[model samples]
Target: MSRPLVIDEAEVEITAIRAQGAGGQNVNKVASAIHLRFNIAASSLPDDVKARLLASRDSRITQGGVLVLKAQRHRTQELNRLDALARLHELVQGVAQPPRARKATRPTRGSQLRRLAGKSRRAVVKAGRGRPDLS
Candidate 1:
């Protein structure tokens, strides 16, 4: 298997922001959450990888091809920062490998027969519900 893409530290911009939700007194004062921003267009990744990353349906990737990640699971700023970087690494790695091409195939003969049989049975049931024809 090919190795995953390694993002350069300089390409990522991390900011420590105040975390939301409950943490008692520490939550109100400490800036433990890390917000990571990486511009795919400006990064050193391969052209194909960049295209794949941008084309992904992930909400984290913005319209301008910038990835935004928030890490606040940890209480400490250092831990949050590391978490953000790890997440970013995974995101890049996700698009590193090309997707497998889907092979088109027709339905099996047995399945087709089963479908036709079901349709005919339904038609018979519907026909039974109709009014009796006068001679």
Candidate 2:
């Protein structure tokens, strides 16, 4: 099992926004949604972790280097806020784990021979598909 991640609550900014879409009168009247924003460039994260987080292709991360997460699934404002912060913690933890470096390797002699043999077989099959010479 993975360890529980502890994110500094001070790093994230949470704002209450009206939930979008069809909620009838309740949507406009109640501010039961949350908008969580974390500035990647200005965070107190390690340099390598910050770089990795910024390089991530997550849709939540905007072009301005801000991680924006909307939490409107829950009915309560506090729940939504917690949900957004949890998501942010998950995102940070994802980048916190460093990836293993890929070792450079060359194809084995048997694999190379098999590839060349497959190519030769394909060429022969294509050559056979052409019209045969009579003369």
Candidate 3:
């Protein structure tokens, strides 16, 4: 098993912004949403992890190598901040371990024969669905 990745809190940039949607009167007055930006190129993560993160297909990752996350699910700034941090941690953990290399193997003779038998049986069943022969 690979070791867990630890991201420095200081490395993450968090900003408070007003969430969009119907939030009554408090929505206009308070900034409860959190905007997070993490620069993969500047982070202290491992080389492979950094490479994987940069190469990820997530649209949030920009050409400048910065990952942008918006957390507005919660009603409070603190909750949104935590949500953003959790998401960042999840993303990092996902690519922390390298995928296992696959070994190639061929089908056994018995299995091949069984597959052929199943195919022939299916063919017979399908053929039976054709028009009946009228004498």
Candidate 4:
């Protein structure tokens, strides 16, 4: 049996920064943006999950195997913090479930026949593009 996945809140580091872009005068004064950082190498997650997370091609994962997420959609700092945590949960949950193995398949006999017939028709059309037959 595999071990259950669990992420401790203490392992996550959260910081509040200023949000960028237009937002009247309040945007520059308040630190509403949330910056969440989770280190995969130092987390309690299973080894497999850690491996998969580091191997992921997501732009959020840094070169040092740390997951960095920035949340600024909400105007309040508390909401942005929650949003960042939610996103982190989603990423961890995704890695917890193993991917289904793919089953190789071949085209049915009827499909193969149809494909061959289409190829033959295309060849005939291309052959017709050549000079017309002379008597």
Q: Give the top-scoring candidate (TM-score).
A: 1
Among all candidates shown, the one with the greatest lDDT: 3
Across 1-135, the per-residue lDDT of candidate 3 in tens digits comes to 777899999999999999989898778889999999999999999999999898889999999999999999989999999999999999999999887899999999999999999999999999999999998
Q: Give the residue spans of candidate 4 off by over 4 A.
A: 1-4, 133-135
Query: Whole-model Cα lDDT per candidate?
Result: 0.94, 0.88, 0.95, 0.92
lDDT of 4: 0.92
Residue 135, model 2: lDDT of 95
Q: Write the per-residue lDDT of candidate 1 for residues 4-62, one digit (tens) a residue.
A: 78899999999999999999889899999999999999999999999999998999988
Q: Give each model's clash number.
A: 0, 0, 0, 0
Model 2, 28-123: lDDT tens per residue? Answer: 899999998899898888788889999989898899999999999987899999889888888888878888899999999999999999999999
RMSD of each: 1.6, 2.2, 2.3, 2.2
Which residue pairs clash in candidate 3? Answer: none
Tell how far residue 135 is off in model 4, in angstroms: 6.3
- lDDT measured at residue 49 in model 3 versus the true structure, 0 to 100: 95
lDDT of 4 by residue, 1-135 (tens): 345466799999999999999998899899999999999999998898899889889999999989999999999999999999998998888888878899999999999999999999999999999998897
User: If scored against the real structure, what TM-score would every candidate get?
Assistant: 0.91, 0.86, 0.82, 0.90
